[model samples]
Structure formats: structure tokens, C-alpha cells
Target chain A: MDMKRILVYGELEKERLHPVSLELLSKAKEIFPESDVQFGMVLLGSGIDGAVAEAQKSGVDLVYLLDDQRLSVFHPEYFAAALIQAVKAFNPDLLLMGATYGGEELAPALGIRLKTGVAAHCTDLRLTKEGKLAQLVPAFGGKVIGEIFTPNTRPQIASIKPGMFLASPQEDKNASLSILDASLLDSVSQRIRVKGVNRKELSSLPVEKAEVVVCGGYGIGSPENWNSLEQLAGKLGGAVACTRPAIDAGWVGDESSMIGTSGKSIRPKVYIGVGISGATHHICGMKDAGLIVSINSDPNAECFNVSDFKVTGDGNLIVRSLLEALG
Target chain B: MNIIVCVKPVPDPDKYNLLTIDPETKRLVREGIPTVINPSDKNALEEALRLKDLYGAKVSVISMTPLFSVDKIKQCLAMGADEGFVISDRAFGGADTFSTSYTLMKAIEEIGTPDLILAGNESADGATSHVPVQLAEWMSLPHITNVTVTEAFETKLHVRKKTEEGSVDYEIDLPAVLAVERNSNQPRMVTAKGMVAARSKSIRVFAKDDLDVDESLIGLCGSPTQPGELIVPNLKRASQELKGEPEEIAAQIITLIKKSGVAVAV
Candidate 1:
């Protein structure tokens, strides 16, 4: 049997390989376990020596490095062009990237340029009987998981959600690297120019990266009441999060920290929801957390349905008491 | 400028609890659930209408859904879309975003390439956010997603796109596709006069034969991805309804927390 080649697009943040890239590398091994399958990586960005070193330890067969100053900050058109060039060079049978802001933009752009099929936010992937890739994803707001395929399209593509797979690095004994000259990608213009970037600083750890997250909702009542939740989170050694309504009401810092379809999706070790009436939008984001415990006054609050532990009581009082008890 | 906005009718998220998965067919049981214009698609249409108001552009709306979605399309018309089209056909059922983009791209081609094409960042149901870029690629036009702010000029468009770390502003030439992010603009409400005008405004239905699309690339049969085993997560949780005063409840919660291995001192 011929080798079934796979390409993993390693995302870079300030010259370091994003952890999701390693997770995708781990996932590629699980999806294609056959001995004939070869894994390749396309790492794009300037000053990527650290990333290149990490890729060496990833056990991939080949590394296509496209490093340039113009590629420092992600420009969708430029990044997509670089990726398409690598695709043509390696001609991999499968392509995977993290379903992140950059990956979401680049993957579809390639689908149009390559005229291939792409499955976005795939939760699972497998090789079919006919040697095609099968993608499994949540649909209708995570109400159902739909199996997807791109049978006729060459180089079937998928963007896996970050945190869906665990990252386990295995160093390769025989690994080779090839640096693709960025100047060759002159055909792709930087059509969309980035004038400025105003970064949102998270005073605490990002909710997605936190091991334990204590989330508040309208039940928390006011921005002043958030102090108690924050204290509770502090006592638990976790970060503080909130629902869309809390963000809308100015009880939370920003939408980036909100838990919902419009905000960041989190899969922490423990998720404690306070005063939240679980909307589907919010549920979809935190449903995958390891353990969910909810406290709400209203017994009928939807948050109780998906929660592993439930408490029927006033949110503020309970939070204050918990803080007092922790002391 | 002529602008086209894509809208999809989705089950009202308020009733998502009533949603069920068909054990055998592996599809959403959406029979009794009323359909509403997807929330973000409304934002897309609202953006288009704002452009029409400021620059006097013509805004048209399109959707690929069952014939039943005609009513939802009319809702778009009632919200000030100049025209509406429903690309409905039995053959188009169960299409992933790729095939859906193919069919929508064909519709856009048939309708003529407007100066700008707009879509919601993603559908509430699919939440893929792929159509805008995929369709733009099919048309070979420039595109952007997660756009929170937009300013249209005579020859170009300026947009602010949202990222995980921050927001970046971009300037792109006209004749591009854009996926409008949620909360970009508040969708206007349906008015009495707009609803009355919708009575005479017709929603054109297009089938597979209506456009220059290859037969194998229009529906589930042409779709490269196929659905496999269905897995509905068991979301049921253990129950312990805390009774009594706030102090007692807080003690119980602390006990539960400590039991979960969190090193909370009591």
C-alpha cells in the first residue's frame, strides 16, 4: 500500500508552537495508525527556531518551514498562500489545523483555492474502508454529532477544536527539515492589511487555560456581587468566568471571558456555575468540562440538567458562605 | 452598491430543551419547534440594510432550506431586504458546509455578483463559520470573518475583526464576501409597513436545475463527508437538592468541593 501522507499546520504564538499543534500531532497518530502513514508539519512564521526545535521532538517525518518577517503577524491571505504552497509541495492526503481564529480563516480559504472539502471543528476523525477520512462534529449547538466526509475532494481537510485531543510528544530518531523560501509565495498578496492590534489583557489566567473555573450569571445580581464570586474562585485556586448575560450587564470584564457560543469555550477540570440559568449557547461552551456543579435559586434552571452536582439556593448567599467556610 | 446577505432559519434556541435526536435517522427532531431567522444572520441583514440606508445600496437575501423556510425568508423581506430567494430542493438535504457552499455559490452566480456578499459568522445550528470563506473562494473574492465593525466606502470596505488575543482592523477592496460576527449590529425589528409590503413581495425558489451546478456536487450524494454513528451525550446528573438556610447550603457545597479533590480548607 502507498503511504497516506498527513500534514499538520503548526500554529505559532510569539515564535513558540501553540500547544494545540502538539495535540494535533498526537491526534494524527490516533487517526492513522497504519505503518505506511507518514506525518508532516507545515510551520509558518518568522523567528521560529524554537518551534522548529519542538517540531523535531514531535516525531513527524518531515517539516516544511516558511519563516519570514512579513509572516510574523497572521495575515489571512499571506498565511493561506504559504499553506497552499506547502500543500502543493508535499501533496498530503489529509490536512489538519486547530479550529482557532487563524485556522478558521486559513482552512476555508484553502478549500476554495484547492477546490477541496473541509470539515471544521471536527471532534473525531477516522480512515474509512475506501480510504477516505470520516469527520465527526457537534451540530445544532452540540445537540447532535454529525458524521461528515469529503470523498471526491483530494487532500481532505479538517480543523480540530483545541483541547479536544491531548498532546503527547514523542521524539523521532530520523526526522528531516526543509526550509521553504517565503519569497516563492509572492503570488499571494496581503489584500487585507492589519492597521493595529489592541490586545485585551486578562487580569487573571485565561478562562480556557484555568484548571478550575467559577462562572457567574445574572443570578450573581450585580458587578459588585462579583467580588464574592471572585473571592470564592480565589479560595478554590481557580479563575472567575461569567455567562453572556453577565457580560452584557457589565458584571464581567469582557466577552472574551464569557462562556457561550459568542465567547470562549472551556474544558476545565471543574466548572462551577453560580446563579446561571443554562442557555444552550452557554451549555455548548462548558458542557465538556470534567465536572460541573451548579447552584441556582430557581430549581427549574437549565444549568442543573447538565451539572454533575446541584444546589438549590440563593447564589450570592451560598457563594459568601462558601468563601467563609473556605477561610 | 448591491449587497447580498445570506440568512438561515434555525430552531428557536429558547426551545432548545425540546430538541431531540432521532435514534435511527440521526437527525434533529424539529417538528414542533418554530423556526426563526438565525440570530447572527439577522445581524448580517441589519448590516446590509444599514449600508442601503447610508449609501443607497440594494440588499437581497438568500437561504438554502426546505420549502417551509419560505415564511422565514419573508421575515427577511419584512426586515427590509429588497428581494429573497429560497434555494430549496430535496436533493440538497443533509449537505455539509462544503456542498452547501457549492450550492449557495451557484445561487450567487445565478443572481449576479453583487458588489458585496454578507453572511452570519456561523449558523446557530451548524456553527461552522465556513460558508463565507469557502463561497468567497469559489467566487475567487476576498473575504473576512469575525468582523465586529464595518465601514463601507465608495471603492473599499474597512472592518475590525475579532481575535482571541485582540482585534485587528483591515481594509479590503469592494466585491468581497464578509462573515458578520454576532453583536455587530442590533437587527432591526419587523415593522407593520414592512410586513404589509411582504405580502406582494415574492420569494423565488430555486432547484438544482436552476443554476449551472454539477449534479454530483449539489447535495448529500455529492457531499464528500457522510454522517456515521450518532452519539448523544448522557448529560443527566446526580441529584441532591440542598434544603434549609444559606449557611447550611454553603457548608454542603464546601463539602462537595473538598470531596471533588479541591484543596479547600474548611
Candidate 2:
């Protein structure tokens, strides 16, 4: 059997290889074993030597390096042109990229330019009986998973969601490198230009790291219930999270406190959802918690479907009782 | 300046649980569920309206859906879209992002290319975030996705795009596509007066034969990505109802949390 070549687009952030690139590398290995696959990487951007070094030893077979000063900033047309050439050079059967902000933009552009289809936020991937790649994507707002396949396209493209896979680096595996021609980027239009960047200063450890999360939703009623929910989280040494409706209700000050597809996906040891009706988006974020407890007045709250323990009562009474009981 | 905003009529989010799949066709069953203008698309239209206010730009909202959602298009008009266009036809059903973008691109071409095209970063139902980029490719124009802020000028546009860490600013020449992010702005409500005004306005409707479209690349037939077996993720858990009064229930929940190796104050 011929080798099934795979290309992983290694995204760069300030000359460092994005961690998701390594995760994709490991995922590619998990799906297709070493015996039947040849893995390659396409690393772009100026001052990408650190990234190139990282990619060379990450168990891939070849590295296509397209480093240029003009490539320092991500211009869609320029980067897409270089990527199109790099893609043509490697001619892989499968292409994967971290579904980072940049990947989301680049993947679809290539899908159209390469005349192939692209799948985003793929949770799983596998080879079908006929050797086609099946990209598992969430549909209907994370209610179901659909197997997306590009039946007639070459280099079947997909952008895997970050944090879904683990990155176990093989530090000893070194790959040969090839410099891609950058002249194609010359003919590309320079219409889209980067003017500035404003990096946000993160203030605290993210909610995803907390073992216990006290999540409140719109049904939590008033800001007083929200305060009790926060006090409950504090007493338990956990963190406070809110649903999208909570945010929309003005109970949530920022998205940092929100738990949903628009916010964060967390797998905490214990998740207590208060007054949340269990919207599909909110359930997807904290559904994997080890212990799912839902406290809502309505017994028919859809969140009960995924809860390990369901409490049908007053939100305020249950939360206050929980706080007092914990103390 | 002229602007075209791509809007999608999606099933009301509150009724998302009623959504199921037609296993044979792999199409979502949206028959009974009432449709609403996708929330993010509302922000996209809001962004266009803001630009219209700033630059005296003409804003036209477009959608490719069953004609039943004409009310939603009129809702866009009520929200201040100068012109509302719906590309409705049986051929446009069951389209994936590729075909959807191609069809929308063809419609925009028919409407004449505007200086800028805007759309929601992703539809609430699909949430793929693919069409904006694909539409730009089909139209052969530059595009930006997840745009949070935009500043328009005579010959160029400056936009702040949301990234993983923060945001990066970009400048694009005229004739580009922008996929606006949700919550970027508070969308205006459709008032009674706007509704009355929209009632007198006629929305332009296009069918398969209305615009020049390649027969092979219009809908499901044009989409290359086919959906295989669909499975609703099993969210089933131990449905143990913590019985008794609030205090007792709290104790039981605390016990369960403690049993799961969580440390509680008590």
C-alpha cells in the first residue's frame, strides 16, 4: 500500500508554534499509525525559526518552511497564496490545522481555492472504508455530531478545535525541511493589511482549571441569587460560571464568567447548574463534569436530562440551603 | 457606498430541543419550529446600519431560505435595512457552506458588487463559520471573520478582528466581506412604525433562474461535503433525583460532590 500523506499546518504566534499544532500532530498519529502514513508540516511567518525547530522534532516526516518578512503579519491573500503553493508541493491526502482564529480564516479560503470542502471544529476524525477522511463536527448547536466528508476534493481540509486533543511531543524525531517558493505571494493582492494589535491582559486563572464550578443561569432570578451562587462557589473553593442567558439578563458582567459554546468548555469534577434551563449551548460547555447537579424550580428543565442529581425547587432556597449546609 | 449583509433565518434558539435530523436526507427538521433572524446576523446588520449612518451607505439585507421566512427578511427591513432580498428556490435547499456561499455569491453578483459585504460569523444552526470566507473566495475578494469593530473610509476599511488572545486590526481595500461577531453591538428593535414602513416596501425575490448560476453548483448537488450517519450525543446521566426539602437536597448534593473528591467547607 502507498503511503497516505498528511499535512499539518503549524500556526505561529510570535515565532512560537501554537500548542494546538502539536496536539494535531499527536491526533494525526493516533488516527493513522506510523506504518501507513507520512506526516508533513507547513510552517509560515517571518522569524519562525523557533517554530521550525519545534516542528522538525515533532515526529513529522517533512517541514515546508515559508519564512518572509512580509509574512510576519497574517494577510489572508498573501498567506493563502503561499499556503496554496505549499499545499501543492506536498500534495497530501489529508490536511489539518488548529481551529484557531487564523486557522478558521485560512481553512475556508483554501477550501474554495483548492476546490475542496472544509469542516470546522471537528471533534473526531477517522478513515472510512474507501480511505476517505470523516470529519466529525457538532451540528444543531452541539446537540449532535455529523460526519462531514469532502468526497470529491483533494487534500481533504479540516480545522480541529483547540483543547480537544493532547500534544505528546516526540523530541527525538527530526524531519527534513523544504523552503517553499515565496514569489507567488508577490502576485497576491495586498488589499487586507494589518494595522495594529491589542493584546488583552488575562487577570486570573481560567474557569476551566477549577475542579468545582457553580454555574448560574437566567432562571437564577435576581442579582441576589447570583451573589449567593458566587458565595457558594467561594465556600466550595470553586469558581463561578454563568450561562449565556445570564449574561444577556445583565447578571453576568463579562463573558469570562459565561459557560457555553460562546464561552468555555470545561470538564470539572463537580458542576452545579442553578436555575439554568439547560440550553444546548450551555450544556455542551459543562456536560462532561464528573458530577452534574441541576437546581431549578421547573422539574421539566431540559438540563435534567444530563444531570446526575436533579433538584426541583426554588433556586434561592436551594442555593441558600446549600451554602448553609456547606458552612 | 453600498453594503450587502447576509442574514440567515434560523430556528428560534429556545426551541432548539425540538430540532431533529432527517436521517435519510441529513437535513434538519425546521418545519414546525418558528424561524428568527440569526442573532449574530442581527449584529452584522447592525454593523452595516452603523456604517450606513456614518458614510451614507445603502444597506441591503439578503437571505437564501424557503420563502416562508419572508417575515424574517421584513424584520431585517424593520431593523433598518434599506433593501431586503430573498433568494428562494427548491434548488437552494439542503446546501452546505460551499453551495450556500456559491449561491449567495451569485445573488450578490446579480445585485452588483458592493464596496463591502457583511455576514454573521456563523449561523446559530450550523455554527461552522465557513460561508464568509467561502463567499469571499467565490467572489474573489478579501474577507475578515469574527470582526468586532469596523471603520469605513473612502477607499479602504479598518476593522478590529477578534483573535484567540485578543484582537488584531486590519485594513482592507474596498470590496471585501466581513463576518461580524455577536454581542458586538445591541441590535435595534423592530418598532411599529418601522413595521408599517416595511409593509409598503417590497422585498426582491430571486429563484434559480433569476440569476446566472451553474446548474451543477447551486444547492445540495453543488455541495461536496456529504453528511454520513448523524448521532445525537448521548447526554444521559444517572437521573437520581435528590428528594426531600431544600436543606436535605443540599446535603445530598454536597455529599455527592464530596464523594466525587471535591472539598467542601463543611
Candidate 3:
């Protein structure tokens, strides 16, 4: 019997594995069930002793630790080189990375170095009858499904988008773990220096985290009327979101507040869409909302299909009418 | 300094009302969809042109798509790229981001490295936001995603990075790859002279053999990921008529929130 091992790259901070790392482990278990699949996680940076122990709890069979200060900040070249070295050494059948900012940048470069194929923004995974890795990805603007297979490559690479998969809870607290030295610290390059790190604070809520969300689209007319939706959201105790059109109109911030495949993926409880025509890119983000209410004047709008409830009338007029009825 | 800008021709998102999928086949029936250069990538091209105006650097454009996209490449040429290259082959079809990046790397190698490379932060079609960073990784160069402002000096590239919460300014060494946000700058319109020049300039076309590349690694056979399903979410809305004054309607909304179990202080 051929052994199939999968390497999941993880970040451990203060002894706790990042949530996405555990999600990868669970997914690997599901894909390679018949083969003897052991989870090998790579931890880069210092103060990860506790993280190594946490990997045991998450069912990681082996942990590769590359403890060094140079890896504290993710530099594409250094990280890619190190990952390439590790993959060459382990020769795992598959490599998985989280679709975070760092992973987005690192996966492709590593793929090029290893001379393998990489599927970006993958939502599902499975193994083919021929024992190759099969990845489910979106194609033609998310309008068509394309089942992709890496027939000629070993260690097929993929970056899984966050929130696409559910992470399984640890069944046992005492799983066996073996720690190995990555020993690739010498390849770290200091060509690029992190002069400073600064984070910004925005006013609107993250669409993904909102319990109730109100989104406006091109049907909102202009940037001036975006405030009306904001007023409505304030009254409803929810946040104001927008489709890709509204973001292009400069009515809302590009990140966090914009709802689409290119922006934030939201799964709010009650999503009230105002004037949104429901483009596929925008609809994919909020399709999981518990109850969706769409309001648009276009009787034949696409947003009507995914919505639980719909109103075919002017958004401003409907908002005003609702406000009046509430009084 | 020489620079290269990569662009993709995608279906204009504004023109199509709703993409129709064959319930049986689950594939988009693209019989009559009008396509255009991706909006964000237009901004990247505009930035490259602005840089050319500032420093008189030569600019080139590259695209990987079907033969039909060459017309869009001509449109890009009219927007002022000194030259253009179109990479099209049957083997390149159904490529995921990783396979796409390898093909792009081959094209870049054929064109030779430049002082800078620019692309849109995300394409409307895939919206993966992975290609630029992946390209940077492949080239072993520094990259700044979601850059709002870009300035080039001797051996240094300065930019304002877009963060989740706010923006931060940073300076990285030159020969870096950048993915510009659509909101960062407005793309300029094509000029008459540029259009005339675009008509005269010849666009170079390449197949799988034009560059030194591994055939198995350049197409669908090499890609590790595949599209499982495309679901057109049902976004239908429920209608209710509110017959009352503005204040009464507002009060009713408040009541509905309370009924829905969302707490309100007022």
C-alpha cells in the first residue's frame, strides 16, 4: 500500500494553531481516506513551542518547526524558497495553504519553483479515480463550474479561501506528534526590510461579521443616495453594504464593506438587499445569509431569485413607506 | 526604464443582466455576451502610461486569452502601450490561477525582465486577487497589493498600501510587482493619435512553443484545482406594502426589528 502524506502549512502564535490550519487538516482527512494520510504542519517563527503541542491536539502527525526571527514578517521570496526546500525534502502528495494575504502571495511563487500546477480560490476538493488531486474552482465569472485535475504533477498545490470550509473540532486531546527541524533559516533574505507596520480603522462594519446587512447596487442611482441606505441600516440596527457597482461608484470603502468574491464573503442572518441586481460575483458572498430580502424597482431583477422575500418598487419609496408604517 | 502591464479581456459586467446557465449542463451559455478589458486592469494600464509620460520609459502590454481577445488587445494598444503580445493556445484553456501564472512567467521570460510590472488587484471574471502576488513570488520580486499611490525614483518604489482598516505608506526597492486597486486612479481615454499608432503597430502572437516552457506544466494538465460547481444563488425578495405616513413606516420597521429579536436601545 502506498502512503499518501499531506503537508498543511500553519502559523502558530503563542502555542495555539490558527483556525484555518485545523480546517486544512480536516479537509486532508476527508480527501485521502483510504491512504495512510498523516498531517505534517510547518511552523515558521519563534515562541511556537506551545503551538507545536497544540498541533498534537489538532491531530497533526508531524510538525516541522523553522523557528527564526526573519520569518516574523512574511517576505515572498524568502518564504517561497523555504517552502520549496521543504516540499523537495518531504515529497508530500499535496500542499495546502490558507488563502490569506500571505498565502495568496506565496502559493504561486512556490508552484513555479516546484514546476507544479496551483488552483487559486478553491472552494472544494476531492481525489480522482486515478488517484490524482481534483480541485473544484469557479470559472467564467463564477457562472460555470470547472473540475480541474493535476494529472502530471506531484504535490499538487492549492490555496483554499477562508470561510469556504468548516473546521472540525478535536475529538481527542492526546494525539501523537513528531517534531522535525525545517533547518532552512539560512535561505532567508533581508533584501526587503519592514520599516513599519500600521493598521487602519474604518467606520463601517465588516460585512462578513454583520448580523443584519443592507446592500445597495447600481440601482441606487448615484453615490449621493448611498446615505439613504445607511439611514435605513441605522434604523434597523444593521450595517450598510454594497455590490461591486456601488464600490466602483466610490460610495463605500473597497475592502470589508464591499460584498462579492473580490471583496468580503458574508453569511449574515438577515440580509436586506436594496437596489442590488444580484450579479454572480456579488451574490456568491451573501448566498448563505439566513433570510434574504431583496428590494428593487426592476420586477425582473436577478436579485429576486436568491432572496427569500422581494419587493418590486423604488428603493427610496419602499424605504420611506416602511419608515412611515413603523411610525 | 522599461515596464510591462498585463491585461485581460473579460465580459463587461454591466451589460449582462443575469448570466444564464443550462440547468442540465451547468455551464454559462456565452453566445451573446459583450466583452471588454477588465475595468481594474484598465487602471493599471493608465498608471503605466502615466509613468511613461513622467519618465519616458517604454511600455508593453501582454494578455493570455482566446484569439477573440486580440481585438481587445488592439484596444489596449490604442490606449498607448508601445507594443502588445497575445498568448493563445488550446492547451492554455481551463487554466486555474496557478497554471495561468506559469504561462505568464513564460511570456515574461520571452519579453525579458523590466524595471516594473503592473496589474489590476483583481479581475472581475475570477476576482481571485492571487495572480499579481503569485507573479511576484515567481519573479522573486517585492510586491505591494492594493496600492493607491505609486512613485518611482532611482532604485526605489514608494507606494501607499491599502489595509483592511486604513492606508499606510511604504517604500520598497525597485523592480517590484504591483497590483493597483480600481479606486486608486481613473483610467484615461484613448487618444486619436494613439489609435492611429495602434493601427500601424503589429501585435506579436505566441503559441506554446514561443518560449522555453514545460508543456505539461503550462495548461489544465498541470493545474491542481478544478471548479466543482457554479450555483446561481436565488436572490428573490418578499414584498410587503406599508400604507401609512413616514413616521408610521419608520415605527413599523422598528417593530419588525423587535419582532425579529434584534435589540434596539431607543
Whose TM-score is greatest here?
A: 1
lDDT of 2 at B185: 92
Top candidate on lDDT is 2
Docking class of 1: medium
**For residues A168-276, could you state the per-residue lDDT of candidate 1 as single tens digits?**
7665654689888777767775567777776777456878788789999988997778988998888888889988788767777567678865466788888989999
Please, what is the whole-model Cα lDDT of each candidate in the order they appear?
0.83, 0.85, 0.72
Question: Per-residue lDDT tens digits of candidate 3, residues A226-310?
Answer: 8777876776668888877787667876566877666666777778888988777777778777767787778877778777666
- Candidate 1: where is the Cα deviation over 4 Å? A1-3, A126-133, A172-174, A260-262, B200-202, B242-244
Q: List fnat, each candidate.
A: 0.67, 0.88, 0.41
DockQ of 3: 0.40
Ranking by lDDT: 2, 1, 3
State how far residue A319 of model 1 sits from its true place (Å).
0.8
Which consecutive 10 residues in model 1 chain B have the weakest lDDT in total?
Answer: B231-240
lDDT of 2 by residue, B182-208 (tens): 998988898999888888777999999
Q: How well is each residue in B1-266 modelled by candidate 3, as lDDT tens digits?
A: 88889899988866444457788987776667788999889989999999999988888888899998898888888998889989899888877677787788789989998989999988877767778876776677787777788888888777776654355566778788888888678888888988999998878988987877787666766565555556553345454544354455446545655555666555
- Candidate 3, residue A158: Cα displacement in angstroms equals 2.4
Error of 1 at A129 (Å): 8.9
